[model samples]
Target: MSESYAGKINRKLLKKRRIINAAAGREPADLVLKNATYVNVFSNELCHADIAVAEGLIVGMGSYSGMREVDMSGKIVLPGFLDAHIHLESALVSPREFVKAVLPHGTTTVVTDPHEIANVMGTDGIEYMLQATEGLPVDVQFMLPSCVPATPLDESGAVLDYRAIDSFYDHPRVLGLAEMMNFVGIIAGDDQPVEKIVAAQAHHKKIDGHAPDLVGNDLNAYVAAGVYSDHECHDLADAIAKLERGQFIMIRDGTAARNLEALVPLLCAKYADRCMFCTDDKHPSDLLEKGHIDYIIKKAIALGADPIVAVKVACHNAARYFLLNNRGAIAPGYLADFVVIDNFQDFTIEQVYKRGDLLVDHGVVRDFPAPEVEPYLAERARNTFHVETLTAEHFSEHRPRGIIGMVNGEITTVDAGYSDRIDVEYDVLKIAVVERHKNTRHIGIGFLQGYGLKSGAVATSVSHDSHNIIVVGTNEADMAAAANRVVELGGGIVVWDGGAPKAEVPLSIAGIMSDEPLITVNEKLEAAKDAAYALGVNPGIDPFMTLSFMALPVIPTLRITTRGVFDVTQQTYV
Candidate 1:
């Protein structure tokens, strides 16, 4: 049923012979780019040559002839961009649709974590994403979710221990364990997280970190436990500390948590090699309207970073860190994946090639077949929301703890201690977290300040880590109505006003992603934002995205869970 070792060696030898023949110009290359000026990653400079492609591998870069040729006289070719870290599920579309949005932006490869879906569907969600991304023109690699339920304080649909994900390490696309969000657990030598770190090390897989502001001996303990990278640094000192301690810093510039501007100093020559670019949670609107990694590269160049250094951070550094040896360069023996840009200053992508095949031409991605998902997985993903019907009384809170204050432009909240006043005029609102998994009917009620909601309610099943239904509103009735609407839609974001849903976007797949085109998802999201704005939500913060992070118990200060308003630092209910 399989070839023998000798047979495999002979087959490889024969292929190598053919590649050598093409390189020596004894035989014609399958395709060649004539008069090309490509970035030489090895030399850290631009050079002129004729690139030869055969069998999807770059065989040579000197004078070469091919059966088919394209004259690329004036264009500049840089290695195709690679996203160091991202959660593809955060795009709120299927992998196929996400690829369509980013391919034209010159993102030929992405390393994604399916933790959002994993928190909902468990291993089934991971399997669905793997199957969905297989065989696409853009390469999709994975880092298994290191913390499924995130922590013991919150309730999630499923819990994945290391034993549960050990088998996934064998998959070719699976790089390593994803962001280990349980930094506290790992530092304390907790059995659960320690075992995971040991297992990843056993397989020689990379372990990523998520310690927001860890310092001193605690940071040392976390790094000593084998977590090699982090994307959560929000300042220069924090990033530099981690970099000096041998952790690769990922400069994140996503829709919700943007740290690129603060971490740009790491893009300089002193620390550039140890840094990479990532968009941890890019919403559909941002992806479609602005751009993907290309947008990051352009922004970096505009922010006083050298074009070559920025490009290297976007491509080569990430590839080397992730151990993807075949790509991230435009040299011999690498995969023929690169982007043709007009120039370094503007960095406007003109064309994109993956394995020598033009996938995006003139900013338009060619149509491709959507990946087939297993019938059972699709059926399972659609039925993720399991909650009972709720009435206005379910959201009623007679006694309230301290207000969970919303920080402008940040997910971190502050403890604006006990406000007994129900003052809607001072921008105070009622916020509730309903347990949607297991139909527990558990609800946590609290008051929120700085939301700026004058009337109506906004609810979403996209709550972070746990994904419980979180709603913020002026009245209990409207909050109940919004939560009920989210459940009725199977799973989605909803804005309810006047006893009805004003705008909604259904995410049927694991209550986090849609199978529809990204354009449709983006349009729906924009409409939802408009509806929230009309209800008097703050103009500065993202209404839905800000609400989604309220349930996550890992972040510092105060957060809401199915239990109640919690103090993350003290590890207890307020």
Candidate 2:
């Protein structure tokens, strides 16, 4: 009992006729904003006009009458902000909770890569997020995880090949392949990476990149393989090099890697068009305390970036890059998504509208239906941990081939060479990555410097790219206890000391996110951080957030995996 193709076409034609009539002033619009000064993204300037809405589309931008009107005489109107790249699971909250935190800040759309959960639950995790984000006020789109296991060095919960994810390309909300973290493999012409790239290219999907310091011929090869964009640019030089070689730049300003200040110079007339704003991985505390994309805009303006250009990068540029052409502008035939603000200086968001419906007013989101979670998916996600009980003997590894030295404010690390003795007095600690997915009892033991952990232990199942259970501690007993506690909670971060848990944040959703409210998660995360700091953890770096990245082998100089400590620069086991 469905309409025929011709019938559907006729129905859409009728709706288009109504929209044209409304724009031509022959019919009353559903809503109108009177005397508005809106940002004209095409013209790159602010223009005064009245915006008319009909059927949730901006049908006109001149004088028009509507059934309902809101006066906007002195306020500034902008297209709703879009996050070019983000990991929603990094917020440590479910899609519903994450929306509540970002919607008030005027982030009406986000293009996310669910690789974090996909590493733990595979395609089922991707399906869970797709269902969890449907029908929310904030439009959530997806890019399929390009590197689920990240690389061959890391052993994740699941291995995603091209055949494993080919059906996802047909999804309406799926944009393309996510970040291609295996740049080395691609440059070397590896078959696995090449096959995935060729498959996505065949579907005409955008392929995102993650080449950090790649330059010269290697960079050319990466772009030649048809990668469209990159969010891993850490400096202006790196971004400019990629931009000149035909790749869109995603200026990342996130929790562990704050690259906005370093790349602020790229927000100019010459380069701003190719740039977009993204919080690649924002933590719970940062999302609640600091704003989302709105925070990036404010900081860009503060760093002497032109207000108008910054707004364009935050809104229109991302929409254009992601090919969501319908909702990024205020012109006719575009969706009526907007962010009304007091001014650009404070960048204070006053009201937000999504498809002509007022979703947020005066820093508060209106009531809407939360996405329905299927009972089976919810049960499957709640029980992702599959590790056997652990003892202190399992963590007793004295010899470490190499040590990972943490960068103060960045996720990138250093090859701190090797040391046989555990020097607790010199801020050296023991770190281990336990393979919790298959429970093969495979543990990679290594030493860590600059973590500043004097005593006790901390463990989290939120390790990046792989989502393995990674723990760091002063001794084997505390390390084993902390890691076991994480398994006991199904999946979570635990801070243990004196043979007891100090604080814990349970992430029952695929070992990465919680279904609780944002504020509650933030409270628990902050308490856990405090407990970590009390145990002599570094105050400069986020304890759990930074620890989570130690297992990501694609990042930089050195990293850890379930196999062993690997030197990323040399591409070999240390």
Candidate 3:
């Protein structure tokens, strides 16, 4: 590591300095941020120090110098934050216009699981995501998806297997396996898919797990089976239990979940080392305003978590767990990834850096790479533009209608929770799934619910996993019309009143996300939320979220996914 010996480095730099130091054999860094304050997340101490860089690597430290210097006086520096789990492809592709929403929040990296796109376009979808995130501000690394259709009962865009896993495991950015959602299969020892885990094991990579409400001997079986992490814990006792069982708890905060408060207390008291933070699935509006994992750090601190411990769980622990040494701490031999924040309580981000490159500054992305994506519109906008043609015929008691009962601002659902059934004879209820995959298959039927929808119909192509078209109504024609309108409008959510359409939020990308900017997406989201309220749905949250994840078959107490109806407890397709 000398000046003359520097040319051999790949994507790194070489520099020469005078420390009259021992022959440790080292070159100078490319750039040096001289005289900065370090918030040592490891020891929770603040120290005034100088950082040096060689090529893109931190080759020197402790009052170091280089060719050029960035005088960071009185500025706060912490490690780059990591987003433990996400769906970058769906996040970027579905809403092509919203990637920057999370970039400015000091979260310089993400461990994304591209299952949403996999369900739509299969392995091709994963490939598309890989291609799309080239050289973006944030390090969009991946965990090779563990579940394609997500559940065995549903048919989706991709069918990933041991071959596909082995194929993608070699890529530099591919880190181990994605969240394994097939808890039942793992417990049953059905190794067809579980072998994928074994394959990653051979590669010596980490394994991420997902088992909602798994407890007692079953939880034991899950952890003993080689799965290492869990993010689906809902209750504090369950989270603490999982932590006691030696599973790293990734406390989650997202559009459908607000578990940070419940899980934060544990991370503060007793088991601080065994926890991390992740946004399982966050919409643009949430990411843009509330934040990525940065919000988690702020929330943890606000709830009595030590600042250093909060930053550790928010930044260092996740990278350490996944063994992503390249980007984590602000120390020498690590990537020059960090955030300059004004405070820890509100967590205001002033600047962000990754691999020594400045990405976001002053609340805006200084640079953003373009992503090329094809829109997946279900049908034209006008095709689904009619109102109720019902005279009370869609009701029943035994053949219960598939209903999506939502929890406010959360993705967890009360599956098939209804005492009422579709009265088909009276034309009171109808349910439909529009094939938003652009395959052009649209189907409609009638259903019932105890959640109580008094009028009109709600439609969306935001169905989870498969993201097919989903419409619920009292009238068959209204349901069919709402579904077709999503197709005709090039994909979006359609709301219908008596004999007319009220509001249509056009989500041109795959019928699930809007290609519009973050602000526009939020506006449309509010409109849809309002429309849902007008329809007599009691859940105060925006309807888009409830509609978007309705097709997700992974988590369950109950759900009405695009693949007909699912019985999660029995682990079978009904």
Candidate 4:
């Protein structure tokens, strides 16, 4: 027999023998949780039982004695929640810091798309994230970024081709390809995307989808290209259509885009099996205030979803879909990853254990210190922020044809038609996207409303997709100062007023993530928000987040880039 086949048989037999021994009282379990009402996601039932674990796998789940045991009289045990899709870099904290913020909330696994970091540092960035997450309490699985720049219309620091991505498929934590944001290219049968899809499929890896508002034959064409999942559905109709077409819909509840409420109606019995939950992009403030996947579960239950169904969506669905064969349940041979809660209604987590080890106790993360980053990885942060010398004259708009209107919550923008002259009095402020990568000296200037910046200016190197320098302000000099300040700090978010920086958050890791503790980063971010509000930016809007999305051309209506104003609906620059 072949070596692979022999190994498979030996593993199956070994598991069966161990399970039998543990159940028959012939072997003592490593750990046991007695008298717990654990959820059975497969049967959709809550059964009172004792769980026996050994070597990080559940060997038995019945009456059993163990070397260590805990009495759970009334608590509910649940499979650890999984975030189907997320961008860890968007939290503005390094992977170590990001896990520290979310693990206490019972998110054991997160499928992260590192395209944000990939755009800035390429494969090295992806490797840094992977290395940082090693041995952490949270299982951070990676999806190789499918589109580095997101599209050719924008310039990015690094470019990842199919050959480059093929090398990462063999990594243990790399699950599959990230979202294919280049939907236009996929539909046009572009050789580059097609080959990437083919390469992933050959390895039997999953391909995530990113078609926002795409429907009809175009949707069919994109699906036919082997994209298995999508998290970009903004409405019920879109969700329904994609579900009917055999696409797994990931209901997203993120920092800027809150679609869970709008799409929760689709989480009913008929379609619950085809749905999962993800936070495609989230900020630190939201993660801290509202719990991670726990927040989604509570909200879904409050909105009248069956508590078990919501649990399935948060846990089982993602694991099965992602082919994480050893997890997603509390059963024999499954990884001993679970959360202890007071009840299903409030879902108040009391403790969390991963791989049979206590990671969080009573809502506090246990002692699992983050590893020191390799010196070579630290060196990658140098020389990233590269913007040409910018001045107030570069931001001045004369006879502008159109303005990029900001929507409060969504990434998409609206193209409010042309204006004859500058109008800062009406809250119409100047917006500019400067090409930071390669120092192209390219600047796209336009007018924006709804920013509510009465004075001063805000800038960030965390621009989505392209990772360029984006600044918005009422005063040209402040805007110029804010933009250049971000460059001088290597890369970060900055707020400038009175011709000086009022507050700044330095993201030294590829201009997107800070290596500092999450608490420190959160403090800096809060300070920046305070400064933004002090400068008369809208109180309801997250000024930094809203400013970041302004340069993403992939989203609808209107967006600005170093090239010029882009009309997403028209699919061309105007």
Model 3 ranges off by over 4 Å: 1-30, 65-68, 89-98, 371-429, 434-455, 498-501, 553-558, 561-566, 570-574
Kindly give the stretch of ten consecutive residues in candidate 3 with the minimal lDDT sum: 14-23
Error of 1 at 470 (Å): 0.7
Question: How far out, in Å, is residue 302 in model 3?
Answer: 0.6
Positional deviation of residue 409's Cα in model 4 after best superposition, in angstroms: 3.5
> Each model's C-alpha lDDT?
0.90, 0.91, 0.68, 0.87
Instruction: For model 4, state the Cα shift of residue 169 in Å.
Output: 0.6
lDDT of 4: 0.87
Worst 10 residues of 4 by lDDT: 418-427
Q: State the displacement of the C-alpha of residue 431, model 4, in Å, after optimal TM-score superposition.
A: 1.4
> Candidate 1 residues 225-254, lDDT tens each?
999999999999999999999999999998
Error of 2 at 153 (Å): 1.0
Using all chains and alpha carbons, the TM-scores for the candidates as numbered come to 0.97, 0.97, 0.84, 0.94
Q: lDDT value for candidate 2?
A: 0.91
Task: Please report, as a residue range, the 10-residue window in candidate 1 with the lowest summed lDDT.
Answer: 415-424
Clashes of each: 0, 0, 47, 0
Which lDDT value does model 2 have at 139? Answer: 94
- The TM-score obtained by model 2 is 0.97
**Which portions of model 2 miss their true places by more than 4 Å?**
1-7
Q: Model 3 shows how many backbone clashes? A: 47
Instruction: Give the better candidate number (1 or 4) by lDDT.
Output: 1
Error of 4 at 550 (Å): 0.6
Sort by lDDT, best first: 2, 1, 4, 3
Candidate 1 Cα errors over 4 Å, as ranges: 1-14, 419-422
